[model samples]
Target chain A: MLEKGTTAPDFQLNATPDQKIKLSDFKGKNVILAFYPADWSPVCGDQMALYNEMLKYFSKHDAQMIGISVDSAWCHNAFQQDRKLHFPLLADFEPKGEVSKAYGVYDDEVGESKRALYVIDQEGKIAWSYLSPTAVNPGADGILNALEELEKK
Target chain B: MSTLKPEVSSSDHIEGSDAASITIVEFGDYQCPHCAHAYPIIKEIEQAFGDQIRFVFRHFPLQESHEFAFPAALAAEAAAMQGKFWEMHDALFENQYRLSDDLFEELAETIGLDVEQFQKAILEDAVKQKVEDDFESGVRSGVNGTPSFYVNETKFDGGPDELFEMLKESAE
Candidate 1:
């Protein structure tokens, strides 16, 4: 997985059928990249729902979060609309799991992304990262703590 | 692995013992069905634990999904000013399926809150801010979803059934 202080690799992924988000575009803003296995899984559903409720907190810290998964933009659109997700869920499809692999969080054996989190600083350097057990909904404490540390510096 | 960031404070709407060793804080959305499902179970836990537990409810509305959530939270906070927070809180969860924008005012009346005062309170900044602040605290405390629980300040990563079972086992 990506480590703190590493310059996060840039990528272009689909946010919606017509909208593409570039990692480099968020250079001046802190970004939370949450790479998970798939959409519609029970744990991922809860994790996204939890983050959906937390968009304001992320915004308060001047941070934007984008969820990355192998799910297609169409799938993400349906899931986001159905779940009422406020943030974007980028599709790491096309070349499936490309972004997840760039972040070194791809699970080759499982054919899915490992549940991972990366808090990238304003300069695009990873400020913090964590690898969570697949079934565990690794909540937002780590991400908030990293944001707090960034503000302190 | 996470703990409640700011800890339970005087502003929290609390039920049960002040001297309780087990304090369970729930960050819940009034319109979330999962929260509604856990509602009876929560009441059961309070009954089972009795004076041994302090139950605190904090607002964490997902306004995007549940449009009535934030308004419901506002209603509860407005009721809090009239010392009927729990009464309005119960009315919300009990009628979660029928939640709507107009439901808050009706609930306020049902709970015996001064109807005119309740209507005015929801329009007040302090009442709205209280719910928003609770949401911030919940986010900082690692809350990821409705019905998220923190027991004695530590996040409990389980469902209500698992939570009650843990408490039951620990009390033994």
Candidate 2:
């Protein structure tokens, strides 16, 4: 529901290592904000793995990819450990659906987040956002392509 | 025997071989209850078909709704690194609701992974990225839901009986 070029909503959530990650912290860098439903699904695993493989590309582009989910920090920690993930997965667990709602990825009917990807520019403006139905999966290349296009600006 | 390969992304490769003439590619989430429901049906089909068919699973975690799905996927991948992927995969689905951190660790221990190394691997950003890439691939291929299947590149629009019939046709 969020449009491109709109200001990304501000957020402060717990990330891995029991630290807090704030949206404003990356004020001068591009951020690939991905919202996924849960931790241990088939498509989600592949999706996160794709990003892990492309970590270098994101870094080369001076971008940070952060995944958001409603799982607890401990769950994220376990997930990160298990997958050898190279990115941070934030814990949006305390308020349960606050961050997801702010991002408009929350599925109120199911009490879970929708599959949505948001590309936030260095200035904290949303450069791109994609929302897929609960049953479909979203692409990492599309995100990379969007970032590439945004960098041309 | 017929062999069908599901479309794969540059980041992933399917490496199993069975003499089955039919191949089924499942775009599923471990966290989605619906997928969990389909799990047994897939198992039944596999048991019934055995070497006659091959089943491939692709990651399509709906991170929006099921909070534990993605991380649980990573855990399965980590277990896979130890050559215990299928074991871990089965365990995850069997214990879907208890996907807390403590539970993950317990599961790792139960599976005999080096707890310290396993923990380190899961926290590594690289691991999460791999899962992310899989997700991106799913989106690219127009997968919008869990338990979506492509039988020989033809989407499965029917239920279990329908899927079984398709499998039979593909085998022929």
Candidate 3:
């Protein structure tokens, strides 16, 4: 998986905003990239909700949060509407797990991404990265705290 | 520009009056072995902290690997429709492996749910959507796996005891 201080790889992936988003777009700002397995499970729901609840705090810190999954944009659209999600849920549907593989969160055995979180600094380098086993949720507040610490530096 | 807003449905908003000062949010899969292992520890933490801590569970089913997980999640939600969410939740974890359709019916029976209503609810695509929504939320929140949790919004990277200690300190 992507590691702390490692430069984030650049890629243009499909997003709900009706266009492609590149890593460079958020340059000069902190970015929280959350990789989840699929849409619509219990723990996944709370995870996004927590982030959604903390949106203002992330914004105040000049950070952007983006979620990536293998589900199609159509599925993601339905998910966003159903949950009233405030962030973009990127579609890693085409090219079949390309983005997930780039991030090293892909599970070759199941063809799905592992639950992972990466905190990328403004310089486009990874400040922190975490990969949880197949049955856990990524730590959101830890990412937030880490961001706060990094901001002080 | 990426804007952030409260992304959760109003119903899911957890309400707790605990001044214990610590909250743990878990993302788990019912059929997941690790989750089954973690369930008791979570219960222990809840018992240990009482009102001093808040514990929330989010669903992250690995559908590709665990075909029964999605159905199991729907069953729990169906039970939730009748105010039996916790009972069904426990049943699912307790009977994690036998998640087949027949077993779901048995669980529904065990949980005192109207078998017909439970079966009907399971057949409804919308009920599945509810579980799906939770999974999507997990993905959006950056959950890449199951049985993962956040301690007062900080990710806990250790075992149950490690998490328990962190929760204890955060409560202070």
Candidate 4:
């Protein structure tokens, strides 16, 4: 996995069937890249739901969150609508796992992104990163803490 | 290995003895069925332990998926302002199947709160901030889901039944 201090490699992924989002477009703002295994997990430990609730807090830190998965754009659209997720769930599909691989978080054996998180600073440097246990949600604190530290600089 | 961050303090909404031997803190979402399941078991645990256990409830609403979660939490916070948090919390869990703004107001009336103030409190920024703060603390404390429990400050990675068995074994 890529470590902190490396430049956050940029990628363009489908946010919806007709929309594409490029990571480089968010240059001046902090970004939170949440690389998860998939969407529509059970509700009890639903990571996406947890992040949805934290959107305001992340906005307070001036950070934009994006969830990346190997799922198709249509799948992401359905998941977002069903969950009412406000953030973009970028489809790392078509060239499946291409973006995930660039970030060095692609699970080759499983053919999905590992449950990972990255706090990309406004300058596009990786401020911090964490590889969470696949089953755990890896909640908002790490991203918040990283954003806080960036503010100190 | 998870531990409670920002330890339970006087500012916290505590429902049991301060000097209790065990402190069980729950980070819960009012709209989550899993949390609703833990609700009765939590009551049973408190009853079984009495003064031996101190209980605390913190909001960790997953508002994205559960539309009524934030409102439910705000209802609890508003009820707290009127010294009726437990009453409101219990009412919410008991009526989890019918959670809505109207239900919150009705619950407030049933609990004998100043209904007008409770209604206004639900929209207050402070009330929302309180819930948000609790959620932040839960996140920092490694709470990944509703009804995440901390026993004596350590995360209890088990269900209500397992927690009950553990507490029961300790008391024996």
Give the top-scoring candidate (lDDT). 4
Q: What is the DockQ of each candidate?
A: 0.56, 0.10, 0.09, 0.56
How high is each candidate's TM-score? Answer: 0.93, 0.51, 0.53, 0.91
Candidate 1: chain B TM-score against the reference chain B: 0.98
Ranking by DockQ: 1, 4, 2, 3
Which candidate achieves the best DockQ against the true structure? 1
- Per-residue CA lDDT of model 3 for B23-129, tens digit only, reads 67776778888788888888888887788776666666765456687778888888877778778888999887676767888988987999899888887887787
Q: For model 2, state the Cα shift of residue B60 in Å.
A: 16
In terms of lDDT, the poorest run of 10 residues in model 1 chain B is B138-147
Better of 1 and 2 by DockQ: 1
Model number 3 iRMSD: 9.1
RMSD of each: 1.9, 10.3, 11.4, 2.2
lDDT measured at residue B97 in model 4 versus the true structure, 0 to 100: 96
On a 0 to 100 scale, what is the lDDT of residue B24 in model 3? Answer: 70
Candidate 4 per-residue C-alpha lDDT over B97-139 given as tens digits, one digit per residue, 9 for 90 to 100: 9887689989999999999999899899999999988988998
Q: List ranges where model 1 is wrong by over 4 Å.
A: A42-45
The CA lDDT of each predicted structure is: 0.89, 0.74, 0.74, 0.90
Better by lDDT, candidate 3 or 1 = 1
Tens digits of per-residue lDDT, candidate 1, B44-67, equal: 999998999999999988777678
Candidate 1 CAPRI assessment class: medium
Model 3 clash tally, residue pairs: 28
List candidate 4 stretches off by more than 4 Å. Answer: B114-117, B120-126, B169-172
Instruction: Please provide, for model 3 over A1-153, each residue's C-alpha lDDT reduced to its tens digit, 9 standing for 90 to 100.
Output: 876788899878888647888889999999998888888876433466546645666887799999888888888889777667788888888897898899899988887777888889999999988787666554454676678888789
